[model samples]
Target: MHSLRNTRLPFKVSLSLLSLSLILPIQTSGLLFKPLTLPPSHPLSLQSYQPLTSATTTTTITTNNTTPSPLTLSTNMTLFYPAETAPHKATILGFPSTHAVPRDLLNQTRNEIMDLAVVISEFEPVRVHVRPEDESLARRILNERFQKLEDINNNNNNNNNNRTKKAKAKRFNLLNRRTRDNNSKEDDIPQYHLDRITFHPCPTNHPWVRDTAPVYVLDKSNPAHRIAIDFGFCEWGGKNLREINVRNEPLGLEADGEDERSPVSSRKGYAAPDNRHWENARFAKRVLEREFDLDEQAENNEIKVERVVSPLRLEGGALEVDGEGTFLATESSIICPHRNPSSSLTTREAIESHLRALLGVTKIIWFPGRKGLDITDCHVDGEVKFIEPGLVVQNKPHPKTGKAEMEIYKEIKEILGRETDAQGRKIRVVELEAADPDLVGWGGDYDEGGEEELEKEQEEAAGTYVNFYFVNGGLIVPAFGDQKRDRKAVETLRGLISPERKIRQVYVSALPLMGGVVHCVTQQVI
Candidate 1:
C-alpha cells in the first residue's frame, strides 16, 4: 500500500508532465509569468563544468572569461529554456498511485515512467520523488532494471569497463558544450551501476512535473549559481476544481464549499479544494535549492525562491525559448480570458513584458493557438520545439485532429518564417509530420462502453513525435508502436540534432491519452 503518512501527500498530489488519472483532467502546461525586457543576446558556454563529480552541487559554468554579463543578479539567476541539448545537472520525475485509477492503468503508467527515467539516466542524472510509502516499490523496480543491465554488461564486463573509462575521459573534454560522442555500443542503454539516479521523498499532485515543478535558472553573472522559480499551479486555473472538491467530500457528491467559492457559481471563481498542489512545487524548489547548494552562498544574497506572483498562470510547456533571445508561445493558452482572466497582462505589450521578465526572451513569436483544442489550451511544446539556437521544428497537423489545428500550424509557420530572432537572425523552421493516431498504440483496451466514447478517447490520445525530450547526448522520443512512422520519426529527429547525440525511443502509448508526451512528464535541471 502507498504510504498515507501525511494528509497533505494524497494520491492526487502526484503530477506528471501529461495528465493524471483524476476525473477532471489535471493535465495541462504553462509557467508562472511576469513582465521583463529582453536583454541582448550573448554567447554562453559551460567553461567550468565537471559532471558526476558532486551529488549535492552542480558544476558551475561561465559565459565568457572577462566582463561577465550583469544579469546574474547577485542570485546568479538567468532563466534559460534554451535548447534541450544544453547541459543538464539532472532530470526530475514524480511517481503517484491513486485509487481513482484502475490497477492495470496504474501499473502501466508506473512502468512507463520507470522506462523514461532509466533512459534519461543514461545521459544525465535522474532524481525521483515518491511518497515515503512507495520507496520500496521504486527501489524494487530500479533494482530489477539494474540487474537486467548487469546481466547484459556482464557478458563482456572487462571490455565494457575499459570502454566506460574511455567514455568518462572523453566526457570531461566536452564540458564546455556538455556533449559526448554517440559512438559507444552501449549508447542506447544505460550502465548497470545505477549511480546516476537518486530517489528522494517528495509529494506531488499528479506526475506532470514539467508543468507543476519550479523552473530553474542560472545566474547571468555566475553561471554556477542557480535559483528555483516557483510558478504557482491551480490545476489549470481551477478547471479541476470540481474533481478536487468531489474527492474531498465524504459522500463524493454535492457541493462542499460555499457558493461564492464554487467554480460553477462563484464571484472569486473556482478555488482548489486546498493549496496542496502548491506544496509539490514548493517541495521541489526547497529540495533542489539544497541539492544544488544554492543556499550556502548566503553571503551572495540569493533569494531562496523567485516567485512570479502574476495573474498570468502558465505551465513550462506553454513557452519555448532559445536561451539567446528568441521566444515562441501560443496566444490562446496564455493570453485568452479562460486562463488569464483579470490578469494585469491586458495587452500584447503587457504580455510581452511579462514574458521578457519571466522568461528573459526579447523577440516573441505568437501563434493564435486554438482554445479548447486540448485541455492545456494548446501548449507550444506539443506543436513546436527549438532544436537548437535559431532553429525551430514544428509538427505537421494530422488530418484527424481537424482544421483548427491546421490553421494554427499554418499561422505559426507563416509568422515564424517572417520573424527574426532576438539575435537579429531570420528564424529557420523545420517541418515534421506529427505521429498519426494509427501509429500510436495503447497498453490495454478501454472499457467497452460504446464505440463513440472510445473513439473520442482515442482521438484525444493522438500524441506527436514533436513531444520528445532532449538529454546530454540523446533524445528520448515516444514510440507509439507504429513501426514505420516510429522509425521515420526517429530518423527525422536524429537528422536535426547534433551528430554527437543519439535517439532513445520508449513506448509511451499512455502519454497521449493524458494530453502530453515525454517532455511533459520530465523537467530537466539545467
Candidate 2:
C-alpha cells in the first residue's frame, strides 16, 4: 500500500487527436449522429500497459468448433466479451442534457460528469457524447473550467480544495492538452497524446451509457474488428419508477427456488417510459451507425466489424463478463417479464443459451436481484466485480446498511467464496468496505438530499466502492469525502491489482441521489 502511486497528469500532448478527427472521412450531416465533431483530449499512452492494439489477452477462452447463435435473429458469429480490466482503446460518456436529466438534478449531474470526464481523460482518450443542444455548454465547461492554467505552468503541490463563503471551491488540476504553452519546464511528458477528451454528437435520454451503450465484443481470430451487441436497453424495463406500472408476480425471479420477493419499485411509484427513454434504448444502434460501416465492411473480404440486435432486453451494467468463458448476471434485470417478455426467453436456461451464443459464455452465474429496487432493477454490476476468472472484488456490508440490503451483500459474498469459476478454480473474493455513515450522509444533514434520499441511497448504493471503473492503467473510483474508508479502498485495490495500475479517486456527490457512481456513467471501447 505504501508503494502505491496515484494517477499523474500528463504534462504534454500532441495534435494526433486533432488529426484523428480531421483526417477520418465522416458521415453526412443528415444522419442523426454524424461521426465525432471534436478532437479527443489525448490518448493515455501508458508505458506499463500496451496502447490500444488488436492483440488479445494472454488468457484464452476455448470453445467447441461449432459456432453458436445467441438469438434466433442471428449470423453464426461467436462474440468474445472482454473483462473490464482489459486495456481500453477509448472511454465514452454521455453529456447531461436538459431533455434527459431532471431540472433539479441537471446542474449536479453535469458538474459530476465534467469532473469525471476530466479525470478519466488523464488515463485514456474520452469520447463524450453530447446532445447537439448541449454541445455549446460542453465546450464552455471544458474550456473554461477544465482548461485551467493553460498558459501558466503551475506544477506546485497546491492540489487541495479551498473553502470560501462556506462553499468549498474544488481546484481540479485538469492540465489541458500538452497542447498548451511550450514554455512549461516539465520534461517527463507522455510520449503521445492519446488521452484526449473530445465531444461527439449523440443524444442520450440518460447520461448513464453503461446501460444504453452497446456491449462490445470481438471475434477471436481478428480482435480489431469490434462487434456491438445491442441488448435493447428498455429504460431498465420499459417502465420507470415514476410510472404507474405494477406487478402482481413476485419479481418474476428466484434463487435456487428459494425466497421469492415482490417488486419493491411497484410499492414506491412509477414513471412511464417517455420519448427520451426510448431514445436511450435506440442509442446503441445510433452509435453503431455513426461509428461503423457494417454494410460496406460485410461486402469486403477484410475483417468486418458489425453489430447484432439481441432479443434479450439487457443493459451493459446488468451483465458481467470474465474474458474467460464465464458470465455473471442477475435474474431480476434479465429474466423479468418487462425485459424478456418474449416467450422464447422466459426460462433461465433459455436466457443462458442466448448468452452463451452471444458472448461465448460457457458458464452462467445467476443472482436473484431485487426488481423495482431501483431504475436498473438491481444490476449485478452494483454487487460484484470479477477482477479475473477466479478473483473478485465485493463490498462488505456497510455499518448502516439495512437488514435486507446487508443480507444481499452477505449472500453475494457467501456464494462467491464457495463457488468455483469456469476454470474449476476456487474463487478469491476481496471485500471493500464503504465509507462511514457520517461521511456518506447516512443520517447527517448533507446539502444534497434529505432523509428520503439517504434511505434510497443506502439501499441501492450499499457497496459503491466496488463500482469503481477500470481504465487502461488505472481505475476511476468514487470518493465520498471519507478520508479513512476511501483511502483504504484505494490502498486495497492497489495491492490486489498490477503495480503499473494507478489509483485515482474523485469526489462524487450527485450520482448517489440516482443510486450510481462513476461506473454507472462510463463505458469502455473494445
Candidate 3:
C-alpha cells in the first residue's frame, strides 16, 4: 500500500499545478516530472492480498506545486418569468416622495414591515438589498464637503460655513455683553445656524421611484441579456396638492447640482430639478449599456434597451404583471385625458398594442377604476395583483361604503370575461374585500393656510390600505391601526405568498393626503 501511494504522487502534483496555472500567470513546466513506480509486496501476494482491518497507515509527499488557484465567482444567471407565473426573482419597488406622508410615517412603514431579505428568497434564494433615498443624499453631502474644503484652501479662507460663523462672532462681540445676553434670551426668535455639514436638498416629494426607475427584464431567447423598460412617469397628472410635488424631478439631480455650484461662494444652492420622461428613458438606456455590455447595434440581437413609444402615458404604479403573459391594468389609467389626450386608438386598442410591444403581453385583464377619486387617476395595482397565473387577488369595496366600488368590480368581471390575450385566452378574475371598512382613510394630512383650516381638511381626507407596495421579499401594505381590518389584510396576503415570505403591514396615515395609498405611491420594476 505504501509503494502504491508513492506511484500516484507525481500525477496528483501535476494535476494541482495544472489547475493553478489556469488561474495565475504561472509556468507549469517545473511541476511536471516522470511518473513514479512502486513494486508489489511479495508477502501480500503470498497472503492472497488479504486486506487487514486494523492496519493504520499514513503517507506524506512533498512537491513544488503547493499553492492552489484562486476560485472565480461567476455572475448570477438571470432567470426569466413566464409572465403567467409569480415572479421567480427580485421584485422592484418605487417609493413615492413628497406629500405621500411625513418622514416619520414613511420610516415607520419601512421599519414595521417590508422585510427585504424574505422577498428576494421567493424569486431567488438570496437577500434583496434596498437602495433608499438617504444613500443618494449622503453621497451628495460628502462631495460638497470636499469641494468646500478645496475652495477654502485655494482662497486662503473664504468658505461659506466658516465665513458665516466668523460674521456672527464679529456681530456678537460688538454688542454690549448685557444686550447680547438679552438677545440670546429671546428663545422664540428663530436663529439661523450654519450647518457645517453640507446636505443635498431633498428632491420633489414624488417618492414613486419604481415608476421612474427602469424595469429590468431578462430576454427569454438569450438568458445572458437583460432589457430595462423605462416607463414614462408623470407627477400623477398634477393631482397632488402637497408642497413636495415637483413635476418631473429625478433622483440624484439635487446632489449633482449642489456639487457643481459649491465652488461659487456667492451662489446659493438650489433644490434638485425634476427629470423629464425622456431624460429618464435616456438614463435607462445608458444604464443598460454599462451594466449589460449591450452595443448600439445589439438591437438586432444580443441585448438592447429599446424605448416603446405609447400614445397612452403610464407610470409603473398603474400596472402589474402576473409572471405569465397576462397583466392587469385599469382603463382609467390608460384612457384618462390626463395621460393620453389625442391618441388614435380607442382606449382598448391602445392598451393592447402598448402591452404587446413593450411587455410582449399576449393578454390583458381590465377592471373598472374610479375616476377623479384618487391621484393615480385609476391604476389597477391599487386594486389587484396576480398571485399566480389564472389566479388574482383584487381589492374589493367595503360592505357599507363601497357601493360604487362594488358596481365597478362587477363591470370589471364582465370586461375580463370578454377579454382575451394576443394568444386568445380568457383571463380568470377573483375579488377580495378591503381588510377593514372602518379603518379607511385614517392617515391623511393636508396644509390649509393655518391650524384651523388644517383641522377642517383632516375631517375630509381619510386614508385606505388598499394602496400598498409589494417589495422584493415582503408586502409593504398600509395599516390604519384598525386592528380587525389590518389583521385581515395581513392574513389574506400571507395566505397568498409562501410561508417563507413575510407580509409587512406599514401604517400609511400620510399617504391619503397625497391622494393615494401604498400602491399609488410606488412603482414595481419587473
Q: What is each predicted model's overall lDDT from 0 to 1?
A: 0.54, 0.56, 0.38
**Candidate 1: C-alpha lDDT:** 0.54
Models 1 onward score TM values of 0.70, 0.70, 0.52
Tell me the tens digit of each residue's lDDT in model 1 across 1-526: 0001111111232212211111111211232222122222321211111122323222211122222222322244455445566788788887744422223345555656776777677788887877677889988876665554344434333445554443322221110011123443443344422677778876554567777666766556556645555544444433433233223432111344322221221122222343332343254443543452423334444343333222345677776888887888888767754443332334566566656655667788888886655556677888888888778888876566566768877988998888888888887888867656654433222122221111123243545777878888788887654445566777677677876676766665544555566888888776
Report the alpha-carbon TM-score of model 1 versus the true structure: 0.70
Q: List the RMSD of every prediction in angstroms.
A: 13.5, 15.0, 27.4
lDDT of 3 by residue, 318-412 (tens): 66776667777777666654443323323576456545555655566666676655455556765666665555666665565445556765776
Better of 1 and 3 by lDDT: 1
The reply for model 3, stretches above 4 Å from the true place, is: 1-204, 238-312, 345-347, 400-403, 416-430, 435-476, 512-515, 520-526
List clash counts for every candidate, in order: 30, 23, 33
Candidate 2 yields a Cα-based lDDT of 0.56
